[model samples]
Target: MNLNIFIITSYSFFDQDLEKLFLCNLKYQDFSKNFKNYENYSKLSSNYKLDKSKHWITNVTHLFKFSREFKNFIKRYTNYYLLNCLIFVSIEFLPEKIASVVLGFISFQTFVDKFGTVFSIILVTILQMSNYHYTVLILTTFYGSWNLSEDLLIPYFNKIHFTMSEQNQWLNTRKGVLFGIGLVYYIMMQKFPLISFIIYSNAFFNMGFLITKITNEIPDNSKSLGTWSITESVWDGHDKFLGESLTS
Candidate 1:
């Protein structure tokens, strides 16, 4: 997981930085072509420096910024986590007979998604109900692996400028790989709870090298697993709210 995270983050960071450099160079080229006055050129250079300083400040204080994007991400993912828990708890509270029926319904929904969400709740519920304590513990470690993958890949997604639908499509197509990466991350977290963040920072670079290799070698037309309707709806709603908030 750490390696995957590292790879994705490294690719995204370098990609974005290269893009910025390209754009800045182009702007300078245009400015030079126009043969602006020395004072105007000086002003333009100062403005660029000012913008860079502001960007640095923003990065330094990002954790305390509470920007709209951060708020939206937190709200959306929190809803997903709560919805998953609610589904699991509701299933557990059902009578054994009815629980089976509910499980069938969940199975149907997952099938409709072509097993895109990986039927995670169904597996967890079954394991718990069957009283497979050790198995449940192990499975639980990887239960929210998808979410972890999504969290770690945010930089990559942003760098590529993927729309909501595009993001979902990309994720669905790579579900198995992402899940495996996330499972490794979960294992590390369990093994090194206190120093997990430090470990993650180091592994991030390692993951970037792997990502570079994978992207270079693999074609993009791989088969997709399926999309998560609930997640899609939540993202849609979040976007709508943001749009309306901005308009008003």
Candidate 2:
């Protein structure tokens, strides 16, 4: 969209503090090592330079620098999105009784867009495996609460990590927990066909997005291409579901 709008949203969401863009222009090593006195640092001001490279076009391909990860990400996510579109069509065609059950998939899509596809997928799978209507109801409320919690907690976590010397230890611990959780979901997916389909589809979406994140350095755009892609997908899904009602 508009550059100014993108910057404002990114500043609000991605850059919680004003420091990120400032730090991007600075050499972290220089600050860590050469901070003897204010005078010395002030004198060395001319040494730092901003990177002014061209950004990627947010298309399927880049001319000079080919990102294999980006390519694979596109391929995987396109397949997943198309499969979800098919599921939507099938849901639309079903009888009212069956459609009511399948209608839950629309809620799943909404959750996926909000909390992230992978996390939402795992959560829905867990709800399905629980086989309790009350449990599902509880989790639906929990998800809304959890989203609010993240907006407060994430900044605090980022501050803590920034200050702590044992940040790597905390990172490792978080990774271990995530891995364990993912493994549990994997096992759950094996038992349930619906869960399996959702888990795989969401996994594809998440994987592609993650790969794009890892390869973000290749793109010189200050705005996140991955964020744009997700927004585009969400709109596309919305249009597909609403059909001509979206226009009205």
Candidate 3:
């Protein structure tokens, strides 16, 4: 997957406001402290140097890296150029579906490439879960709640398909009931104090992702991984998960 293209797209999006990158790069501590003027600029410059190192890979330089697997993969898929040409070359035929046409073209490239890296930055931005950079690794991966230990054991559950109506009812009825129970639990949780605090903490943090399910709006596409919905919420919230057995 020619990741140079995705890197360029990430760069272009950030380039829209040049100063924002600089401002966000500044150490919040120093700005709050408001030290001597010259010392502030010098510290900011030093901080910016480290920040650039963190963000540079997301810039133009990630285009090239040594990988024998990458070369062999590209060699095996020599038809991609022809595919790109054939798709765009026939675009004018769909005069009525202009949006669909453009979308088809973009999706073709993105699908072929599997745009994990580009969209990840946007997801991380929305979540505000990681540093603008990865902080520890060379790339921004596993935006939050990731650790080295037991990375493999964490199970991934894909579509255990439920019909939209069943899914909706599960979310609206079951989840709404749990949410009401959760609210009551949260209100009186202070009585037990510590145990209640733990329950409330986990509940509020968890309810962050579940509020969508308590409504009937699962996103149409599931190609994007780890895109959670209310189904997971009710399964956890209401103790009625069918596991991988259920299917649409």
Candidate 4:
């Protein structure tokens, strides 16, 4: 078990993803320091566009209800949370070392990769039906932590013009490290859900810095793990809707 834990831990930290987490923390600290300067503080305040006269709760509610980005975050968070839970449950039946290896490999796959998603979902459903409530709960919290960590680097990925497929492939090929970096941010977001948006603002710069470092180290030679018809269909539908929305 100790060896298993060490293997998992080593794999997760192999690419120094934890360094990216630290980088984000340092960036957040620098951002907080800017609040001490009136000009810098005012500049920062202008970006949020929150009305002072409104109740804080009302403003937050509005942000949750109407912010597209927030909605997308919620969607991604929920999906990944569930997916990770299933993955954790699936691996639990295996021996420690084998489980660790399986976990690492699956984590490297894209959420929608081929039949993996369907298989995981089916397995999770079977387990849930078997009444493993306590086990599922624990795994959900464990796997969900670093699941959405990639969201922080959206700005960098966008700047580099990486499509969803490309992004997944790239991350999949260089897995473990990004998961480690995301774990810290995930804990922070859980502890301070309301302030996540603010944290994300600072995270953008950190992502840019981290991505530059990552790209320099890892050459982008990630090949596709085959196409998922469902994913492609969804993307196509989304593009069609976007086109119509723009035209109208």
Ten contiguous residues with the weakest lDDT in model 4: 38-47
Model 1, position 154, has a per-residue lDDT of 47
Model 4 over residues 1-248: C-alpha lDDT tens digits? 11222222222222335434544544455456432212222222111234648776776576466443334455666665567555566666766556554444443353335347777566544544454444344344445544445555432332233455665666664455466666666566556767764554454445544443344222222232123212321222335434654797
Give the winner by lDDT: 2 or 4: 4
- Model 2 weakest 10-residue run by lDDT: 211-220
Give the number of the best model, judged by TM-score: 1
Instruction: List ranges where model 2 is wrong by over 4 Å.
Output: 1-65, 96-248
Q: Candidate 3 regions off by >4 Å?
A: 1-180, 194-197, 216-248
What TM-score fits each model? 0.47, 0.25, 0.17, 0.37
Q: CA lDDT of 218 in candidate 3?
A: 33
lDDT of 1 by residue, 228-248 (tens): 222332222335444654797
- On residues 146-212, what C-alpha lDDT tens digit does candidate 2 reach at each position? 2222222222232222223232333332332234334444444445645454543343234322222
Question: What's model 2's TM-score?
Answer: 0.25
Give, for candidate 3, the lowest lDDT window spanning 10 residues: 148-157
TM-score, candidate number 4: 0.37
The 0-to-1 C-alpha lDDT of every candidate, in the order given, reads: 0.44, 0.35, 0.32, 0.45
Residue 82, model 3: lDDT of 46
What's model 2's lDDT at 181? 35
Ranking by lDDT: 4, 1, 2, 3
Clash totals for all candidate models: 5, 0, 2, 0
